[model samples]
Target: MKKLITIPLLFFIVFPARAQSSSLEKRVSINISNQPLELALKMLEKEAEVHFSYNPRVLELDKNINYKAESRTLDHILNEILGPSISYKVHGTHIILQKAPKRDFYISGYVRDGESGQEIKNVSIYEPQTLASALTNTHGFYKIKLPVQQKDIDLKFSKKDYDLLIQPINNRSDQKLSVELQKTIKPKVLTAEVSAIKTPQVKLDTTPKIEERLSSNSKPQPVPVPEMEVKEKKVNIDLSEELAFIDTTYQKGKDHFLNWLMTTKQNLHFRNIQDSLYKPIQVSFLPFLGTNLRLGPVVTNDISVNIIAGYTGSVRKLEVGGVANFIRKDMTGVQAAGTLNLTGRSFAGVQAAGAANINLGTSSGIMAAGATNISVKDSKGLQAAGSLNVALSEIRGTQIAPFNYATRLNGLQIGVFNIAYDRTRNSLPIGFFSYVHKNGYRRLEFNASELNNTEISFKTGVPKFYNIFNTSFSYGRPNKPLAGVGYGLGTSWKYGERLGSNLDILSSVYFQEGEFSYLDQHYRASLGFEYKVFDRLAVFVAPTLNFYVGYDESLDFSSYKLLLSERTSRWLGENARTYTWLGYKFGLRLCNKS
Candidate 1:
């Protein structure tokens, strides 16, 4: 990234506009920007069903604010957007989202002969919970994910070649077994001429016991008969063997080659985007990437806003803020913000930010970006500003800078562009801007950013679109006092995949105010990879080969210097990001370029 790294004007914030008075509203516009675009769009459908289920009517408000129409507030918008399909819990402004489906109980096993230990095929297993029934495969194995609770179970198994078998479990823990068949025995009839077959006979006599005879006049006592009990023929069990089966709820994670050394915050800060980006994707006649703070692959897309917001704590006095987006396709995007140390401590100073990006680009596409310093008050305690800039891009296509300056060259744009500056200043101030672009060939751009102080940088390149490599050259102008050119050459390579790689190498020569002066020189090489081995997400990695050379002419000696060039990248992996729903959160921020 050149010195003037901040993007000029961020893609404006667009949202749905509403009229305060209305009854029986079938629909309304939603203005969700700087929030999660992917997730928000999905949440809209669930929220819009106000006619009945989920109570959308309750989410909708019938009131006015500052003489405005009855409309939804940010809080209500969030509430409605969070519908019932997804289980979500909210604390303060942060939301916890979770999805719950009927739990699955998996049953898997093999079948074999009760005595021969031979694998059995076409064996059936059934569970009523899921109406799941399966036959053993060729390997005599069967598996199922169902809902089978603990209870005595009944299952019937029948094979054309074998006899029907009914297995009943008196207890849930009873192990299942197989059936064995034996050959039926045949009996021969006996001959009638068998010798000395004797027939025995028994005679019955009616008599009374000695005690009963004397008491014959009294009532006779009832006789006690033996008890009758019948039992099922129990299935044979090999008690020596221990049957093992365990029900569990563990899913197999997909295979992903992740380089743990690659963390998100550390990688997304790579190659700063120069301030001269153009917008080819837009809604209005104006040249814009998106309407307001919303951006997307097409005119209408969603967005996501996931960040922690807080004012300077009394103890820490920390002012922190960040905005995120799903600019390309999925919600996977980038972010940038600032923090002012308000702790009234030794380290208490306003911290400005210039970041590259925050997204894991696999869901949507590849991206490149940069953020400019927004700190109006510097470490030196200056109030006004040195300069402000912001330059962020998704993939390598159109840039969204409307205020930056550019020269319409064939492929090498030469002129001053824009710098992203922090607008939350101590007092109000005004400035001027310029911009130009042509959508042919490899792109070229230049930018000049700031207030009072100055910074300059330029980029010329063939966007490595459908092909593998992007060829290019870059130069960062010395800030003010040393206003000269610093030059470098490089290219990038990528294989589009969940797991992909990228490499770039470039060397630069810096010049001071004098044309023949050499202030610095260096070489930078980088390696990166992108992988999407998970659901609705992708991971990114960026590491670099860095070396720098510094010289001081005042000493009349040329010295070789070696310093490491820090490289950065991002993994903002979000999908279905809700930048703005067309019928809902879709409006434009009006800016007059004339």
Candidate 2:
């Protein structure tokens, strides 16, 4: 039984191995004369017991071929019948025929200074169109490969402070090419004759030139020169343009302790140069100790992985850090951090962090944080945070947090407390309390209704939607009074400058005999017509529909002017009674226009 099992297992494994062996090793016998290449290949395929795959256009199947083979390896027979450009690969019993690619052409040599005849390191040699590049080693040697090209290919050599060099070569074969770079001309510094004399006062005629005059101007006679006052007047000069080529120094603004631990001054000097260089990948332990080394802050990378915190010029794809990530310029990709994320300029992708996200410039994507999110300039996306969200300038998206603030809001805000300083008509703030300082609606209303002798309500928010808090009181019998305090929402509309209408819905709990022994719930809806009497004052009258549910019959009904009364059935027990009424109210309102 053991021998039989072993034989079956061995047969199964051996058969698969043999079947998967290269089909090109199979022997074939064939003989054909004056046959088309297509027919010849078909004959060989049958003899070898293998399938052939090839592009007819590339294989020139119509070409005539005279071939004869006897018991020869399939590879040998095919090689003899095929041109040098055609190649083949075999898999099991199948064969794939393809046109062979041209050999890669290599350009390898040293880059040296033209004047000094010394090797230059770190010189960038690249093909502009393909972006195939190689950097010179310490010995100034570089080797780069280029694809097959019929025309002359141009390779560019660039280095900071050196003139860019482009060389063209038409050779298809590998070649050794060495070139020298020349230092660029120094920038021309402008010279200004600054004087220390504050008042050298020599008055002369103030008139346009005689030949260039558009209109005639009165010319004044010259006055005697006055004694000079030696007071220095400082003049500021901007060399941003002239010195831009050599200005690699980065702007290290207000310093923090992280600067000492994460970056070096020498690395900052290469920021300008590194800004022009693009790299595919960067791995860093910190800002100054990374794959790009001292130039980490100047280079934009496609994929960046930071063991701790990292600082880079920008990110084109994805960036992740164990602690935090700082970007010197704009980022156009997703960035994630364990603690915080800070971007210097605009950002246009998703940014998330464990602690906070701060953008010094505008942003236009989703930013989420555990603690807070802050945008210094305009923003146009969603900001969601655990604690707070703030936009110092303007926001055109949504903010969801415990506290949200913006200079101007053009979208929605949802939080515990929302504050927007600018009056934006399109903004909707939904929270426990929302305040718009400039053009928010606020009103103090004093009104009297048939059901209550005295009523006062305070409303605040935008005129489109606002919150209301009100209180009502009534004198029933001697020493027996009724009082209610409630909250509601209201909206208002204007017909013209001074005339408007409002709608409000409110609910309140009434207290009777200075005790909470019985439940008295009141519900009402009011529609009011208002007219402005002065700048900050208005008068209004409203028609109200009121509903009241009571449990105690001993509670006085003298204070209520009810139109209908009925005994309630089951919800609040046999003592419950329901009352409904139609009432009217007149009021004086002190409000700010919104």
Candidate 3:
């Protein structure tokens, strides 16, 4: 029973190997006059049930093959037809046919400068025939793997500001070659001046002749010489030396200290030493505890966990700190801190801080801070803070804070007060006071009303809303000639490019015969249509509703009143203290439009 089992196991293993070898060696009759190499290979593949692998670039696929075989092995036919330069090796059931490999070789070493002996980095070492290339590392070490080829290979080494070197190498085995390159000297152009004096010598005849002629009796004239005036030279005064006498020793020291402080702050690396450390995960008891570098000058990690604080050169994924998180260069992922989150360069993704989020450079993602959010250069996303949001350069999105300030804005600001130093066209400021230095609107208007014949109004604010101050003087009226001052609010709505409408409400007190008494008070509301005749000039007409309150009979409404002809209605108990009338107004305005 044991012999029977062993014999069956041996037959099962040996029969498969024998069958595979027989399949490779078996061949059939193939008769073709001029067939493509691919078609001929396909015939062989069908008969032998095998696949062939070779580099298509090295094979002539379109070439015609003419062969006739009768019961010849595939291996014998391939060897006789494809020549000795091409060979085949059996790997499992497939046959790998390729150009015969010569010998494998490699070249590796360091590249340096000829004079300084300093290693050169980023030097390109290439072989043109094989298209194989390699670059030197920071230490100027390079290794190039070469395939089997001709005996000799030429390598070209090149870099900027250095002369290129081409060396011919024989590939017998692996080699270690160290090459030094020389610096190229640029030629300078030299200029020289050549003077040539080639004049022919000529003889001159010395002769003086005075011909006799009729002389007229005329007086000799005297020529007057003009006097030359001398111009005074200007002397330059040196104010720098004169101003040096002023005592600014304390100011100089203060400025020096401030500059030093800024430099130190920018150079404050979290790691104490400069070395490359890539950690997949890091955990710290405190900011300084469990850290290889005392400060951690250059720590790059995927994730970081801190008990009190976290300091790293850069964080790629996530960093959570109990108190604060400070990054020296850039933080690309989420960073959360209990107290502060500060980045020296750029901070992308989400950043949340309990106290403040400060980015010294540009930021593109969202920032939420309990106290303030400050970006020194430009911010392209949202910044939300409890107290203030300050962008020194420009903001492209929204800013929400108690107070918002930006140098230039292209977004929206929602706060108690918003201020932009430059003009902003796309930014809308929604606050109690919105101040834009270059885009504010101011106008002076002269208007005439039924109660006040002549009035001068000053309007100043943003284009959408403005404050109005008006003073009016009326003469030739039924009552006494009065002067009054009023304060109001006005807003504008655009109808077209050069036309708009305005709504205004105002209240005023009139002074009668130079008396400082509030015996008469006037309230007016008007809606007007404004058209811009010129860039700085506009005209407006409005119908107004006026209410008058007088202690005595000092209310007037008689001249050119468009409406409310009757005054018999005692709307407020028939007393002279209160009256209402309808009127119309016409005005001309001059202002700057943003």
Candidate 4:
């Protein structure tokens, strides 16, 4: 009983003492003058009642030390003696000292306009290679922290309406920098006859090192302006600019929601952010739930898989989505989706979708869709869709769909209805109805042919190729009561001011009382002379060599004489008769211009 009571007393006494010594907050007094660090620490250990533990090489115990503390906390004494090169941790009654880790460097500066010397806010300051960026505040002040790097950093500053500035920085320590930007100036307007604008001279600064200005105890000092050089850039500006489709209009309903969801940081900073960080792979359930976190749309990925839908900055290799893939910028490789694929800028490779593919910028690729494909700018490759294909600007390749539309076409279009708003001399649009708006041939004619007494026809397309639709009535034959409708293609050439020639091939189906009957096909080569009688009216007469193919021999031919006739079995089967004859036609053409 006496031994147990004594042991308990000893434990209580020792536990309190150890707890007091363990805490660096404990007050201690020490005075060591011009003593070795090894000896000084030994003296401090006794005063603080704590053991000093460290690697001798790191602590450099042989170094001389001079420190004094009067009733100060152990923490204060240790901080003064250790300096910043070494750090210490407490464990029980012991202090373990080790070398400190490398510190992060800071860069802070101001941005101003070159001429006005006024502060400019919202200017983007970034390191292109590292993608480390910061923006200037309202006061045009900015700050960024950077890790230790081996080489110099290339920093860039950019803003709209201002010239881009690039600064090389040596980030060995903290620094302060100031930059000036010149505003972009518009050239003087010239006469309408001038097709291009001359190049302008620009002032570009020389790359200079931004010196370190930060000190351990004081703030950064003022920075000096770097030197620059004046350089001339040869530029030819065309007044007749190409059209581009960028949705700047306000949106509502579903469009608004989808755009909001797919909108990314890159879209807002495309002009300033010239580089994108590469990501080898990305897997996402949705735009917000991706492996890239909130920066999903600011990185280019090699392979991207989305379960439902995904949004990204760019695609370098392949991207597939269960529903849709929305790209904020360019796509260079294959991109496929179950429902839709969309790009904010250009695309260069193949793109396939179950429903539709839409690109707001130029497309130089092959695009296939189940429903439709739309390139709002220039398209350079093939596009095939089930329903419609549309290129609002220019198309340099073929388009095959049920309907096709382009502002200018340099290739071919195969669809039921094709329309080109601009002039195309070498393009061919093969369909039931084809229309070209500029310098295209379109005319409505009323004429009497040898076979049908009353006929009305409409022609629309380019002069090189056009579509024709005509319907005729044989009114005097009451007993037969025949009506004919025809579809054909024709080519026209203007010989002079008032003379033109046309070659047409038409196949008309004649029926009585809307019942199927026989087919009448004819090829006519004629030389027409048209005299403009009014602003939108012209009278033309043409003498033609007509080769007629008639399926029904029961039709009377007493009114007209044939130069040549042959009876044989052809596409319409037995009793098919072919006749060659000379015919004459006179018509009034109603058109937009003569």
Query: Global CA lDDT of candidate 2, please?
Result: 0.80
Ordering by TM-score: 2, 4, 3, 1
Runs of candidate 4 exceeding 4 Å displacement: 1-259, 263-275, 478-481, 512-535, 545-554, 566-580
Q: What is the lDDT of residue 535 in candidate 1?
A: 27
Q: Model 4, 95-210: lDDT tens per residue?
A: 88899877667789999999999999877787644456677888989897666763778778888788889888865688899999999787888766856778998988875445
Candidate 2 local lDDT, residue 137:
82
In candidate 2, the residue pairs with backbone N, CA or C atoms under 3 Å apart (3 or more residues apart, or in different chains) clash, namely none
**TM-score for all models, in order of appearance:** 0.18, 0.56, 0.45, 0.56
lDDT of 2 by residue, 248-334 (tens): 322233123224434434233332142255678888887767775555555778888889988777788898999988877778889
* CA RMSD of all predictions: 39.6, 17.1, 21.4, 24.4
Q: Show model 2 residue runs off by greater than 4 Å.
A: 1-262, 270-274, 473-482, 512-519, 551-554, 558-562, 569-575
Q: Rank by lDDT, highest first.
A: 2, 4, 3, 1
TM-score of 3: 0.45
Q: Model 3, range 154-213, lDDT digits (tens) per residue?
A: 877777678879888875578899999998788977678777988998988655333322
Worst lDDT window (10 residues) for model 4?
A: 243-252
User: In candidate 1, what are the lDDT values of residues 1-594, reduced to their tens digit?
Assistant: 543443322212111112111112324455444445344434444444321123333332222212111355433453355445444443322334455333444545676665577777655554322224456677777664444363545444434445445455343332434444222234678867778868888878777679978867767689999998988889998744342221111111100111122222111211111111222222211112212111111122122221432111011122223432222212212222332111111222233333432221111222222332221111211111122222221111122322221122111111133322221111111112222223211212222212002222222332221111222222332321233233443333435533444343545444444555434543445454445444223344445444434442321111212222222222133211111111101111111111
Between candidates 1 and 2, the lDDT winner: 2
Instruction: Score candidate 2 by TM-score against the native.
Output: 0.56
* Predicted structure with the largest lDDT when compared to the true one: 2
The residue pairs found clashing in candidate 3 are: 270-295, 270-296, 271-295, 271-296, 271-297
